[model samples]
Target chain A: MKIRTSEYIITEVFHSLKRNSWMAFASVGTVAVSLFVFGMFLIIVMNMNRMAVSLESQVEISVYLEDRLTDSEIKAIDKKINEMNGVNSVTFTDKIKALDIFKERLGDQKFLLDAIEGENPLPNSFTVKVVNPSLVKTTAIAINDFEGVETVKYGQDVVEHLFDITRLIRLFGIVLMILLAGATLFIISNTIRLTVFARRTEVAIMKYVGATDWFIRWPFMLEGIVLGAMGGTVAFIALRIAYNMIVAKIYDTIAFFPLIPTYPFMTYISIIIVCCGIVIGAVGSVISLKRFLKA
Target chain B: MIEMKDISKVYENGVVALDHINVSIDKGEFVFIVGASGAGKSTFIRLLFREVLPSSGALIVNGQDVVNMEHGDVPYLRRGLGVIFQDFRLLPDKTVFENVAFAMQVIEAPRRRIQHSVNSVLDIVGLREKYSCFPSQLSGGEQQRVAIARAIVNSPALVIADEPTGNLDPDTSWEIMDIFKKINGGGTTIVMATHDKEIVDIMKKRVIAIEDGHIVRDEAQGAYGYEN
Candidate 1:
């Protein structure tokens, strides 16, 4: 690989690209479209995973106490829960604090609770967080058996359904990614094959004139890289713009929606997409050049 | 520069291209391989460059074993030989200079040496002044001359051509042949396959004629014996 040969290969790459400008344009467009779709799905799947994780972390058990429990009895229950495995934290909310929270949540409708205000009907409960969200059910059931505990609730059915949906999303994302990647490779290679086919006689001439396989392949490989890089850049820019608009819109409508932040997350996605584009481009060139290089 | 012993070529569809042939060509000998269509002339030229392997034979071209040579070494073997074809397969977009310089570039020759050798070969082909002219801008004969310049730029010991003048008029054909004679006079062995009887008879070089997969005649200073 002398400097001169490298120069020659670079020149040849640009020369062929210029000669077949239309084909090059078509190739770049196809790569961009394919990679854009890939990047879109990548963003969606990543944000879904993030949301699922955040939701899982929010899962906790609530143990309501039986009426007339003394301070010492509540203390005993708290110490027992502390000794249990997988308990991250236990915060006891007294009925008075619960009532205050309910009043705040009711906002202007606090008048609706005026009838029961003096009785202090809200029960004292411990909000329990576990080290692992998946253990919420088992921990809640165990706490329900305690002498002072009246009931345990942790949105059991809702949590189960959420887990199921998130699992399905992850599985579907993986399958979709694989299919899109395969399709991208196929399309890019076919486009490259047309370019190679057009210049097949040129390749034959090179072979007859003693050009080594690599000598002939270098230009095409470089062409693929160039096209891939261009396409990746295009897709990255498009994804960036589209993601920004969507993020802004979601924040405007649903501020608390757990969408992944746009900065480094998108940066990472762009890098992955561009790198995949490059790899796909190189592989496509190799595949397309295989039959022609037999000379 | 080439030796073939007990060579035979049976295509997969069972067409016998060359059969039980034995021939030896020494260095610097100008020979013409002449035959009718489908008479194995193309296969003979292809075998010299190791483009096609004989079904069973020992082939030595330019001191390299053609049949047993490793795949990686094929390019090295081809490097020592120049090959031309009837279509004058020049890159339509490349200038005459670049087209000739391309051969040297393929072998990764030094930049200065490529520039110098390409100029010299273009000079030999009498296209030095047309160095910047593209293939589409050249006449048939001039395009073939450019092809010759490219083939010889690397100073291959042997030049193999198949129908070098097939696409040109009679005068243009003769013009292409004059370049071949000039090249051959410079001690480069040339093996050309052609159907041009006039040039074959006039050149009076050693001729090998093939018919139906076998060489029917081998003569020095031979005439174009076929009526067609």
Candidate 2:
């Protein structure tokens, strides 16, 4: 209720914080470590998923068409499949050209060459590259039902497993974040509680002397926020260092994989870290002050 | 002015602290609540500030019906009163000036006004030279005086001193009582709780004696009279 009067609470809180800088810093440090691990896990999991999708893109599905189909009908079906969505590119392989490729591959084997010469079983197929490998199964089902299409073939099992793994990773990431956040709040609140306990006498006197609840609660809450933010900053720096180290190792060994953009990832991670710090700190202060501020 | 009508406080275990207390005091009247330990002196003081709600009855301070007052209004009741404890209760981290300024700060006084008022209160308590000293650094007597200064810094209408000199020696007790008398003379009503028979006899103020949760005696000019 007393705006100017609450300044006294702020002044007193800061004075107490200054007196116990080591303790305050230690508490904040604990929060930072917890949040850092959480953020690091999220970033790594996301990158791993991206890497999986990138690897799955290398497999392509090819559907063979009946030789009786006209050139116009073949072009129409290709256009229709492309227009149906998720189809990236469709290239036509002529039956004669496919036979020539097969002959060249089996030219050293006399029996394979003789069998291919006698049967001429190889047919013209459309090599279809989809936008997402995970959609290949549905695309194959649609292609199999289409007129004049012989069969749809791709690494379906590998794609299915990759999708399953990505889903599990996402689910685990969410659960892990919730648990980490809860732990962060617990540790920070306990830390702030110790500080609150030290000044329980001061809080009691202030309350008895007519200090409003919020007036008594604000400075401690702010103290928690400051501690959280400080810890978050430390965590941010550690994460960036860790990110760079890990990214460099991955680039050195697995040069084929796509790495996350450093600048954007850092920016997002920083915001997340700061927000986590503030929330944890605020929650901690509220938890710590609940009992002591009772009327 | 303050009024109390049959205010009673009974603990859950049936140890009655105050029993059907009816009393009233006009503006600027200095009074004392004197009794032995467990005689409800502290309970009576706490009642006026709304620190402990009476079990039953109507209590009014500054025209506000404290019995039916909401929790939000308790601070308003306390604003018009200044309560001091035996323990100084000064923030250990704050300087003497800051400690005294806290009363004004709680009521949201302007910064310039706060500085001026704190300086004046510290001067009244004779601690202007030790404005920056922490409570631990001050003497017991000086600390009590600072506590007194903090209590009256906001110019409250009524001052409650609960054994203000409980921890001081005889000389220091007299010094502290002198400060209270001076404060009362300045038109702030005082209801001090003390069992110091010598101080009570010398001061000759209106004394109300509480014996086992009952007001046994009320005198216009009374002394410490419970006799244990």
Candidate 3:
């Protein structure tokens, strides 16, 4: 572990990289491209999943009450729905107010409402929002079974399909990330292999001269790690710049899309990507040297 | 020191490279193995460095049982050896100093000591002024000399040269031989395999001759006593 020896190894690694600059660039480029896609996919998945959760949370169920109920009876039913499990809030609207809402909803059709002027046909209802949107359907069904409830609806079909698609997309993102990691390792090692193959004679010479296997392996491993880190850094910077631009554009046009705010979340993601790069680099170098290092 | 009671090697293709080769080389002895092509010289040299295992025999080098040694122990066994090759296997891009310095670096020698020993070895090979020269910049003889300096830099007890002068001219071969003699006289055991008859005939050392996988002769103070 002499400083001089370490310096020699570092210089040797850098020299070899300089000598095979073309292959070195190719290795870095491959790593950068693969990791860039992986980072982008991760960012997008984070935002999409957050957006889905937000949309799910905003869903509310409407329970139309049985007709001919008095004010006290309606109050009693409103209190019952509010006390139900998972119900965040419940607001009761009587037939008179329902009629007013109908009139507002049909601004140009006020004459149609005047035709039934003396008789109010709208049903009084309770609009209930739940803590967890996923439990909305079950809570609605439970309320529908209540004595004063006539019907319950919460955009049942559309919400179910949305959840399924989000789950599929999450699964796909995980698989793609794993595949990209493998591809990065393969390319980095193969590219470094060309450099190692070129100097196999040096390895043979070192072997014959009684240099230990690790002694011969250190410089090559160092080279690969540096190459991998370089690729990771490049990919991280590219992802950050591109992500900031897209996030700005998305906010300016359609601000409702729920994005993971760029702060600690981005910092954590960058660390993960860079660490992957380093690990891939180390593993690739070790794998490529396995055959040659065998005594 | 080296001992081979009954060493034999058979390739997978059924070629018998060496057969029942029994010989003993003592410590600090300079032995030359002379043979024609396919006469088992290379195999014998390789066996000393544990480059290949013996098919059947008891082989020991420097008091270590080499025949039954595991794969991981081979490098340690080699560390006691200074191996030179026919190709002058110098790193093409490293300067002569770095090439020699590399040996000590592999063994983790301190910088001051490495500097001192490398300089002295370069002086021994008479290449002190050519330390900064690359392999391509040096002539064949000078490069072989650089190879020799690298081999001895680690201060190994035994030096194995497999056709060290195979690619050198007559004068350069003599110069390389002179360095080996100097190294051997300094108490390092030298086992060199070569077919350079003129130089071997001139330098009367202990010569061991192999023919058809058998040791035909093991003579002390002997000449290269074989004809092509």
Candidate 4:
């Protein structure tokens, strides 16, 4: 690793790349496309998980009070629910606030609520969120037996189906990511193998001239690193631009849809992808060199 | 600088390349190994450089055990010797100077030493003016000379050439031989495998002839006794 050797290796790598410009282009292109696809799926899986988490966190039990409970009795019920295991927070909404929320949700059709304006039938209810989404059903059932509580409803069937869907999404995302990663490695390595195969005679000559395995391998490994870094940069840029466009489009159309913000999330994804590209590049070169380096 | 005791090579396909060969070469001797095609001459040269292992025998080349040497040590063994091939295996992309300098660079020679040694070796091979020319720009003999320059750039104790003149015309082959003669005169042991009878008879160096996996003759100042 002397300065002279490093200089030689860098020169050799650049020389080989220049000599086999087409092969180098093809290798870098393959790596970029493969990593781009991987990055796209990764972004999708991450955002899906984020959305799933947001949805799950919104699941809460609605505890309606008995028709005419005193304010003190309602406060007692709130305290009791707050002390319950797994209860994250309990917020009581009076009948007037319930009516206001219903009207807001009605949006441009708030005129429908005009027919019942004088008689607010909404009951006082506490929205109870649990520490864990999976505890929603049990927590709701436990809250139903509280004194002075009318009934607890957490949209049991809808919550159950949402959990099932999110679980499926997470499992599918994991399996798909693993499969895509393996495929990317296989393809990138094979592309690198072809480049190495083209220079195999050079390797043989170096070997005969008493070049150590590392001495001969250093240039190729460096070539791989360069190609990988270049490809990773291309993919990172493409992913960033594409994600931003998609985020803008989604925000424009479905403004309420939950998407992970583009700041640290994309930054993290870029780091992971570039690192993957580099590692795959280095590993691919080593694997390709294995057969040729044998004496 | 080489000792082979009861050497034998059996390829995996059950072809016997060499059989029970015993030979010892001193340090500074120019020996030519002559044989017909597939007559085990190549295997003999290959064994000297530890390119292929002996099936069962002991081979000591430049004081290193060729047969039992660790794989990691093969490069060290090869470093002490120079090897040339008939096809003039120069990197097509490298200039003549870089090609020769590559040998020194492989062993991590200092930059100044590499520059100095490469220039001197190029001078020896008479390729000083053609240092910037690629292999494709050179004629067959000139390319071989560049190859020679590269092989000897490190000043190895021994030089091995397999058909160094096989692809050149007679005149060009002789020109390549003159460089080998000059190198050998400088006290480097050279083991060459060739089929050129005229050059062999004229040089009158030690010759070993192999046929069908066995050495049939070993003579000092011997001629290539085979018909073309």
Worst 10 residues of 4 chain A by lDDT: A112-121
Q: Against the hidden reference, what TM-scores do the models get?
A: 0.88, 0.87, 0.85, 0.87
1 or 3: which has the higher DockQ? 1
lDDT of 2 by residue, A22-137 (tens): 88988878888888987898788778777766777876888988878898989888887888679999888988889888778877774666754566777778988889777788
Candidate 3: which stretches are off by over 4 Å? A1-4, A59-160, A244-269, B12-14
Instruction: Give DockQ for candidates 1 onward, in order.
Output: 0.67, 0.47, 0.60, 0.70
Model 4 DockQ reads 0.70
lDDT of 3 by residue, B71-98 (tens): 7778788888899999988999889999
For A35-81, candidate 4 gives per-residue lDDT tens digits of 99999999999899988989999998999998789999999999998
- Fnat of candidates, each listed: 0.77, 0.52, 0.66, 0.80
Top-down lDDT ranking: 4, 1, 3, 2
TM-score of decoy 4: 0.87
Predicted structure 2: lDDT: 0.85
Per-residue C-alpha lDDT of model 4 across residues B1-228, encoded as one tens digit per residue? 999999999999999999999999999999999999999999999999988999999999999988888899999999999999999999888899989988888899998998899999989989899999999999999999999999898899999999999999999999899999999999999999999999999999999999999999999999999899
Q: List the residue pairs that clash in candidate 4.
A: none
For residues A1-295, write the lDDT of model 1, one tens digit per residue. 8898898888888888998999999999999999999999989988888888888889888899988899999999999999999999999999999999999999999999888758888899999999887899999999999998999999999889888988998998899899999999999999999999999988888888888898888899889999998899999999999999999999999999999899889899889989988998898998999998874
| Worst lDDT 10-window in candidate 3 chain B | B219-228
